[model samples]
Target: MTTQGENIAERIKAQAVSLGFAACGIARADAAPRTADRLAQWLSEGCHGDMIWMEERAGQRGAPQALWPEVRSVIMLGMSYAPSRDPLALERACDIGRISSYAQGQDYHDVVKKGLKALARWLVEEAGGELKVFVDTAPVMEKPLAEAAGLGWQGKHSNLVSRDHGSWLFLGAIYTTLELQTDRQGQDRCGSCDACQRACPTNAFPAPYRVDARRCISYLTIEHKGIIPEEFRAAIGNRIYGCDDCLAVCPWNKFASSAAVNKAFLARAELVAPKLADILDLDDAAFRTVFAGSPIKRIGRNRMVRNAAIAAGNSGNGAYREQLERLASDDSDVVRDSALWALQRLSDG
Candidate 1:
C-alpha cells in the first residue's frame, strides 16, 4: 500500500545506514526562513570572522532551492565521530598538544562525502533523478537542514546535538529531484542547560546559540591569518588545532555512541598527545607528512607552528625555550611573531 516515493525513501534510509551513516532523514527542500534570518543577523553583527565565503554565497546558503531549484527533497545524514574517552583529558597536559576529537583522524569531509556520493549514485540508479551531495564545502546550511529532517537539533553551542550520538556528529546533505517522504523535525531539548557556554575557554559564546568567532579559539588558531591577540593566548592553552571545551562539557555527550561503533572516527595515537617540542620543530615538508590525511593539514605548517608556539608559551614549563627560540626566526611573519611572544612568556616565568 506504499507509494513509490515512500518506498524509495525507505530504501534510501536503509542504504544510508549500510553506507555507515549513523542517522538519516529527509526534508522538503524549501527556503529556511528562520535560518536565513539568523544568518543575516549573524553576518550583520560580523560574527563570521574571516570566513568571507559565508557572506559571498549568503543567498545560496540561506535557501536550499536557491542552490538547486529542481531539488524537491533533501536527504540529511549524520555520521558519528564520538570519542571513546573524555576529550578534555589533556586540558592540563602542558608538555603535550591536544587536537579536537573530530580532527584526530582522517578528515570527516572525505569520509562522509564518500558515503554521500555513494548514496547519491544509488538514488540515481533506482529512482532516476538528478542529485547533488555536499559535505561542508558548499554554502549549504547543513545543520539547519539536518534539524529540519529530524536527525538532530542545533544545541546552545550552535552545532547539531543528536540524542543517539551527542555533539560528535559529522553532517552531510543530498539534494534530489525525487519527491521523497520527509521526517518530522526534531525538538529543541537543550532547555535551561548552559554548560556549553560556561565551558568556553575564551568566552566565545556571546549568548546562547550565538558565537563570536573573533574570540573563538577554533577560529583564532585555524582561520585567522595574523598574530593571535595576547589577551586570548594564555586561555588557548595547549589546543593547537581546534577547541573542544564546549562540545566536551555538553551533558548530551554522555549518551555518545562509542568510537568502536564509529570506526572511521577512531583517534590516532600520534595526534592524541603529540609532543609540543616535536610539533614546534616541523617544517613545511614535515608538517604535510605528519598531517597527511588529517584535517589539520588544511592550515599547513605556518599556522600549526604558530598554534604550537602559543601552546608552548602557555605551558609555563620553560623547558621548551630552545624550540620556541628557534621558531622566533620562522619564515612566516605570523609564526615568527607568535614564537617571539612565546619566548617572552617563557622567559618571564
Candidate 2:
C-alpha cells in the first residue's frame, strides 16, 4: 500500500510533467548538509571571481531550510534545452561568433519562472500548503538540491549531469510546507571520464568538481562587467556570448535527444552563428531590438560589442578592421579598449 506522502509525490511529479518539466524529484529540506561547507570553501578561495552575490547570499544559498524555516520538502524540476545542432560547429568559422546553446533562445529566467509559478499554484491548490518557487536568480543551490532529489549528479565540470537529460537541464526549486517522501539521492557516475576538463579552452577547472570562474569564458563574456583581461582573450575564440566547450564535450550528452527540448528554448536564427562584423556594429537601440526577449539583452550593448571586438581580434580577419577602428573611439572604455585590441590584432596579422 502506498503512503499518503508517496501519493502526493506521484501527483506532483505528474503535474510537473504536464507543466513541461522533463524531470521531477523530491528531497527533504535538510538534504545535502555538506553543501554549506563546500560553498564556504569555494567562496573563500575566490573561485566565484567578481560575482559578489555568491558571497553575500552564502548563508541562505547553502541550505534550503535556512532560506525558509517552514519548508519541509523541496521539489526539484528540470526543463530540457538540448540543442538540435552541434554547439561547437562554429569553432572553425572565424568570421562567426558563437553563442552558447542556452542563450540562443528566449531568456530562460522568464521561461523557467513562468513554469515554476504555474506549478507552485497547482501545489497550493492540491495540498493547501505554503510554498515558494525559484529559478537561477535565487540564491538557492538548485544543483545540489536536484542531486539530493535524485534528478542527477554533479559531474566533474561542476555541472549537474542527468543520465536521461545529460548536461542540458535548467533546474528550478519549489519549497513547500507539506511533508513529502524524498527520492534516492544521485550517485557520482563520472568514474574515470575527464572529457569535460580536457575540453576547457581556458582550463577553468582547478580540480574535479570545482570551477574557477575567473578564467571561464562564459563568465568573462557575460558576467564580468569591466574590460576583459588580456590573458583569456585568445582562448575565447569567436565565442561572443558564452562558452560551450565543457558542456558540449560531455560524453553523457549522447543520451540527450533534441526532441526533449522545450519549445521555449528553440534557437533563434540570428543567434545560432552571428557574424562578428554584424555584432560589432550594434548600437544600444539596435542591440535592444535584436535581443528583445533573449538572455543576451541583459549583457547590454557595450558588453556585447566588447565581446564581438574580442572575437574579431581572435578571428585574424582584416574585414573587421574598419568596424574595429570605429569602435575604438566608442564611449565605453571596455568597448573602446577591446576594439583597439582587435584593430591591433588585425594589423599584426
Q: Score candidate 2 by TM-score against the native.
A: 0.98
Measured against the true structure, the TM-scores of the candidates, in listed sequence, are 0.98, 0.98
Error of 1 at 312 (Å): 0.3
Residue 213 in candidate 2, Cα distance off native in Å = 0.4
Each prediction's whole-model lDDT (CA)? 0.89, 0.92
Q: Write the per-residue lDDT of candidate 1 for residues 161-254, one digit (tens) a residue.
A: 9888889889999999889888889889999999999999999998998899999999999988888999999999999988999998889888
How many residue pairs clash in all the candidates, one count each? 0, 0
Write model 2 residue lDDT over 146-190, tens digit each, in one string.
999999999999999999999999999999988888899999999
Which candidate achieves the best lDDT against the true structure?
2
Clashing pairs for predicted structure model 1, backbone only: none
Worst 10-residue lDDT window for candidate 2 reads 1-10
Query: Least lDDT summed over 10 consecutive residues: which range in candidate 1?
Result: 256-265
